[model samples]
Target: MTTAFTYSTTYLLDKSHYIETYEASVPADNSKKVYLIAILLALVGLAVLMLTEINAFVAWFIIALGGLEVFSIRFKKPWWLARQLISKAANTELTLTIDEHGISSKSIHVKSTLAWTDISKIEVTENGWLLYHNDSKNYLSSRALSDEAKAFLTTKTQLINALAI
Candidate 1:
């Protein structure tokens, strides 16, 4: 006979979870590329000013603007985009159940279940797992789960050939 294992947990959403989830889900901005292009533009403008008779003021202005762009990219401050999004439904309660059958979840505004076969992908984040469906994703925080539950989830996701990252 085989024994079945099930795990359940309930927790309220918090700011840190929201920020971490957002960082995991969204790709980093391409600031490096932007900065590189800015440098090239500034160099070209300087060359034109020195080699040709182009207006010195315009050339210098372009160079200064490029420098500013680089500074902005390097020391850019973070906006409240993530905070605003999290605040809208802050402290929302969520419950998750994981069993041999699959995963079932309930939250303030949504309730759904995803079978192992139906899961498109599973991404193991630094502090949680991202369960991907066709058009949506659910984030399950590691803090809410026991160590055994985490191991079970990792094993099941691997058995189903789900991509883990």
Candidate 2:
């Protein structure tokens, strides 16, 4: 089974808009968690060191590590960090094409197009439907699509499935 949908950012964005895709969802909440955890860990470590009266060198090491962790979480480049973390955590492939004209996609071995023959499976998820690729193990998602686009896509998928069967 194969299905296809055309993706274009032009409909959703302005001239300055850029399309960005990650192999995984951006951990929008991770930064806050990082900050909280770092603060707590650093404070706890400092308190323990002070109570235990650990050697200066050991205390410095602990403090330094904690500070480093905090610094990294606070100042690290989010785009680069997102790429690295997402790349490592998710093996899925994602491609996002953005230009003045519109947006396009070619993910999971499926070429970017509006044609229905390019899709394999469409399974609904909490956010949206997961569109599978017939030629590869990778998957693409419809989470970013608007209601109108999703409806259009659903219709296209049904048409494709009908033809395929």
Candidate 3:
């Protein structure tokens, strides 16, 4: 005889969870990178202008483009979160079901299922777990999962986090 383990939880995704998920997936922005690239492009444009004499106006235009990058820095994480709030992410009701077979998730906007074989990898972050498949991923906050569910994930998905589990 075989016994199966099944667990499910339904909760509303808070703003912080979305922020955490975004932070985990998105690379941290280097504020100086924009300035560095702008400076280099301006220098390169200036050099090419000096060398080839291909329209001095074009070189100045390239230099002028730097202002756009500087302007974009204002739209940072909070700005993104605000947009998300205005759109679909705010107050999303999520239902997560996990069993011996795989994981299933249903939210206000989408529903998805991932078998154990289909889950390529599992990453345990400080705030949550990121379940990665092909091109997309699902985020589960640490608080959303029970200890038993965590153990099951450890066994099934190769989620090895000595400190977390």
Candidate 4:
């Protein structure tokens, strides 16, 4: 069976969708651990400054900078990266079709097909599916697919071991 759908993409939805899919597929880095270590190191430095009678302002400034660093690492960086990536793409309409043999997609600038063998990974995201090729990725929004189409694609696509991630 073949399943197909079409939808127009917008920057905000696409951006959030991509980020959600990416976070699902890729594991978070050790940056959080690194940030915690940095916080500890900064506190040690602040204590050293106090013991040495260094300027009181400088010691407090180090502690303040460490707090800001922790805040950014925890909250700001992920959104900033999503904005940077999403800004690179132009809004366009997309058509996608999935079948037992392969998948095909078309946007304003590109049309392409990948056989089941060509797909390296497939990940189901919160709002859609992510298809990974050797050098590229494609997103198919669940909102565009009917229940029957979604079932067909899920069953057929899952049969391909090469595509399972």
Clashes of each: 0, 4, 0, 0
Q: lDDT value for candidate 4?
A: 0.65
**lDDT for each of the candidates?**
0.77, 0.51, 0.75, 0.65
- The lDDT, on a scale of 0 to 1, for candidate 2 is 0.51
RMSD of each: 5.6, 10.0, 4.5, 5.9
Q: What is the lDDT of residue 51 in candidate 2?
A: 81
Model 4: per-residue Cα lDDT over 68-117, one tens digit each: 77776676557665664656343455566665567667766667787768
Q: Is candidate 3 or candidate 4 better by TM-score?
A: 3
Q: What's the ranking of the predictions by lDDT, best on top?
A: 1, 3, 4, 2
In candidate 4, stretches whose alpha carbon ends up further than 4 angstroms from where it belongs are: 1-34, 40-69, 76-86, 109-114, 132-139, 162-165
Off by over 4 Å in 2: 1-19, 30-32, 76-165
| Candidate maximizing lDDT | 1
Residue 27 error, candidate 1, Å = 1.9
lDDT tens digits, residue span 50-165, model 1: 98898898889888888877776654334444454546457788788999888888897768888887777888888888878778887777888899999998997686553434
lDDT of 3 by residue, 98-136 (tens): 997788889978797878766677887777777777787
Give the deviation of candidate 3 from the true structure as CA RMSD.
Answer: 4.5
**What's model 3's TM-score?**
0.71
Worst 10 residues of 2 by lDDT: 10-19
Question: Which candidate number would show the highest TM-score if scored against the true structure?
Answer: 3
Q: Would you estimate the TM-scores of all the predictions?
A: 0.61, 0.38, 0.71, 0.51
